[model samples]
Target: MNSTGVVLSAGDWRLVLDPHRGGMVRALTRRGQDILRPMPEGADAPFDSACFPLAPYANRIAGGRFTWEGQAHVLAPNAPGQKHPLHGTAWLGNWSVETGEADRATLLHHHAAGPDWNWAFTLRQHFRLTADGLEARLELTNTDDSAMPAGLGFHPWFTRRGVSAIAFTAKAVWLADAEMLPTVRATADTLGDWKQGAALERPDLVDHCYAGWTGQLRIERGDGDIVLEGEDTPYLHLYVPPGQDFFCAEPQSTMPDAVNREAPAPLLPGETRTVTMRIRSA
Candidate 1:
């Protein structure tokens, strides 16, 4: 259970996690082989990197700081030389184990510390392995007596080596400048014609987030295909690290500047926000 932190099983699938970086190594089900896995440390690896929470939200925030409700808040630098805090504070911290069954595990990460973000709150991440596929859910609550703006998303680096055809449909697009921050609104056309799905030939160089997904994503390879869908998570972040063999299909409720731009639903006093996603093998 604690040898290499790699959860493996021959019955259905395997689940791997690196306790140090809070990374998910592998999540496979009966029908599916593995949803997310750790690649050997080397060149041309699909996703040898770690997965973090994009949070407090995900993606990039210019200058690692943002203005909300006329108040300025600065987050610690998660991305160096970029001047922005990324993926929130949970992914880097060791999450407290709440419950771990044979096929499921629930982890809690409470940032009820000092007042930093618009609202101080407690968050919980639930990781589970089911008969269909692996699933993740994020739950957050506003500890403040008033409403606040908070975004949530997951940064899961999927194996892109064997993946050939990828396709999905989204309705909205956030225009950004050189810094990868949302600037204006446009049709999802600029993201390229992914309607018919494109080969994973050159995706690593891309570092952008997309919104208004139809809740279904299709990923096809030579041997297998996968379909991802869910109810709570409406937005998706498409991160392709240049030259790497993997790409990240992150799901979330808001974008980078959602807190400042008011993109998703608004939170009220004692409001709880939840985002969930499911992956079904095809």
Candidate 2:
């Protein structure tokens, strides 16, 4: 297993995985052109990388607080100057290399019950570069004897350059408050009529989560179009922060702050939940 900047290529697609950098995808390109934002040299954390895995949970947990199984838990703010914990611990920690080969790689992470949250789990991820695109899978198992609530997802930052429009279908949306946490539940078009591919040329920030996603989407940039699909992903999250050169199209298994959601099911001990995301030319 390579520690950093390992490149895998198949046909027109190329992927770079940095196992030591929180098991992040440094870049994803097709035909020598970036399909996702390439992480710059000397870039900071997974936030600066092209893509990274979201485990245990995805998105923000308001004020880093949540209640699970009738017990209250609080997580210290992990991101720079942010009041709440964003994403999970995997994006900021080192991942052990389980296997690395020519067009595929596998990484693993083990979390013990601690202050961050009261749960223990093991996360395994596999990335395979296909002839036309890339495919990845995540399996999270509750290693703890007690039941645990968990979420699985992927975070891919698509390059904003030449980006024209994004198209997807959803039944509803999760509106966010100023703190970037889900607030109101509105129609899919509450932000943009994305059912028909909405142009993203405006300056306003576009950060919201769409529920009831159809499990697929297409991104049309000046370069070309790519289709992204996820299995076991019921929600699609968009984080098009203002003035950024990249935007995120995330496929996740749960809504933000899911731990606090009413009667969330727990992953029983020795139980495993899996999700997958695939990308290819449209």
Candidate 3:
């Protein structure tokens, strides 16, 4: 089956959804070229690429060499660092369309049982269009003969232009190594404070992950505000690239290096796991 893409437009906002590959919201824009950066003449265009995932996993995995169940599985690197296996293959793989109706669509994909997870899997992603905003849900189930470790999340690029203030609550903070991987943990106060619903205004460089989130965030622009409420996501990662057009506010389950740490409960065969998030114009 071909990759499925759907467009939802409201006034000046346009969201493009591709169901086949992790059901990613591949593009978001009004004029489309507003975020264009200078590219090499004849190079592939950025707009043509998928918008990427929004959670559980963002960015890349080094060399795809993580150990699970004492076994190593190689993953292909799809980003700048050749040393890392970027984003899960589901985002690039084909997804079957289960149902499509007005304002909503559902898509599904399956991965073979692996040695580490030991379970066959089926994942479903849902998209719903509404006058308030767009909502996307990702659900996964262990369909294998055994239980396995699983991680899930979102990776959306959000508009950060003229964002005067950002306010939120955080409880946990992770210390990262030079490679940008989580290495340590401490009380949020160690970094500053564990304040919730506090306002931060273009304060400084931030590419940090925070846990103990309430799943409620508000981004205040000069003229408008956007509210994002995450369901089943207790952790949040805020990525603000220097002088970049877009920033990412991701909600995720399972911390980085979960596979190595053998973190949390595994998805048992016949059991389902899900994460959902809602975005609305405020």
What lDDT score goes with residue 110 in model 3? 79
CA deviation > 4 Å runs, candidate 1: 6-11, 19-34, 37-50, 115-118, 263-269
Question: What is the lDDT ranking, best to worst?
Answer: 2, 1, 3
* Residue 259 lDDT in candidate 1: 59
RMSD after CA superposition, every candidate: 3.6, 1.5, 4.6
Q: Give the local distance difference test score of model 3.
A: 0.61
Candidate 1 lDDT for residue 230: 54
* Quality of model 2 by C-alpha lDDT: 0.86
Which numbered prediction scores highest in lDDT against the true structure?
A: 2
Q: Give model 2's TM-score versus the native structure.
A: 0.96
Better of 1 and 2 by TM-score: 2
Two-way lDDT contest, 2 vs 3, winner: 2
Mark the regions of model 2 whose C-alpha exceeds 4 Å error after superposition. Answer: 1-4
lDDT string for model 2 (1-282, tens) is 344477788999999888775879888999899889998886757878888999888888888887777788889988797888988878877787788888998989888888876788899889999887999999998999999878889999998887788899999998888887887899999888889888767778988989999999999866778999999999999888777778889999998988776334789999999989999988
> Candidate 3: minimum summed lDDT over ten consecutive residues — where?
34-43
C-alpha TM-scores of all predictions: 0.84, 0.96, 0.78
